[model samples]
Target: MKNHYCVIMSGGIGSRFWPASRSSYPKQFLDFFGTGRSLIQQTFDRIKKIVPVENIFVVTNQRYNELTLEQLPELKPEQILLEPCRRNTAPCIAYAAHHIHAINPNASMVVAPSDHLILKEDEFLNSLSNGLDFVSKHDVLLTLGIKPNRPETGYGYIQASHQSLDGFTKVKAFTEKPNLELAKVFLESGDFYW
Candidate 1:
């Protein structure tokens, strides 16, 4: 099978992270996990193992181009995509997808946040491989949805379908950030998370 590609989106302001994530230094460049490596560097290295280093792209704002390059030296300057303005995730992703498709039409791209915490390396890679394999054979949008843990009102949630085949859960609907009560119900129901 052809190798998959990964796009690390690090242009976010990270308002929730607060004072720790300043305008000069965003959360993606912070060592949130205390793993010695910054989030952006960790993300770049993690995807490198699965995808060719050249195939991995870092999409960010024009201002942070130098910071992204300094953190991820493995990535070429050209590989770091820069956005002229901040619109939203959808537009950023759409622009990136189109740019990448123009270069490699067969590429299977995985869009991931630069600040997420992944404890299980093997499991994460396995899931990614599955997504790539699925995308290669079928024309579908692949997303890795995590299960919810507690009644947390911070993150959004995705509802998975009843059908379960080949260890992949189907997505039903995506729920925006909910109130504490609704979040508690979601957690107790044991449906999904992100």
Candidate 2:
């Protein structure tokens, strides 16, 4: 997996989960589940199984640089991509992508949020492996979508076509946070995943 890389986006202020998660210390730096590991730390551990620890980059705000370093001390200065300002995920990803491409032009990256909780780690790893394999041979942007078990308006949804090739489906469109009624339709149609 020499060409594989992981980018963990950890710059959000996480205002929704306030009090427990504040601007001084976002949710990504906290061990909210009593797991002994912060959300970013857990994400690093999980992704390292597929990509080398050295190849994993954490993109966070300049304000949280110390927090990230404190949580994951093993990270080198270069591995921590400090954002001068919060421009959201796209720019954060572009920064990392440019850096990674400069280092390894053949790099295939898996960009993930730092504050996600994965209960089925083995399955998640398997899916990641499959995604990596798929991208290695194709020039396409791939994203892992979870079949919504509930009408979770908190997350975005991907509408995929019925076509499935090598366990990967063709993404038709992306819809962000549909209302409860539309969410139910998406769930009932079995065509959407968040």
lDDT per residue as tens, model 1, 139-183: 778788777767778788887788865677778888888899988
Best by TM-score: 2
lDDT of each residue in 1-194, candidate 2, tens digit only? 99999999999997989999999988999899998999999999999999988999999988988889889888898899998788998999999999999999999999999999999999999999989999999998899998999887777999999887887899999999988888889999999988
Which candidate has the highest lDDT of all? Answer: 2
Off by over 4 Å in 2: none
State each model's CA lDDT, in order.
Answer: 0.84, 0.92
TM-score of 1: 0.92
Which ranges in model 1 have alpha carbons more than 4 Å from their true place? 1-3
Specify the poorest-scoring 10-residue window by lDDT in model 1: 1-10
Candidate 1 clash figure, as a count? 0
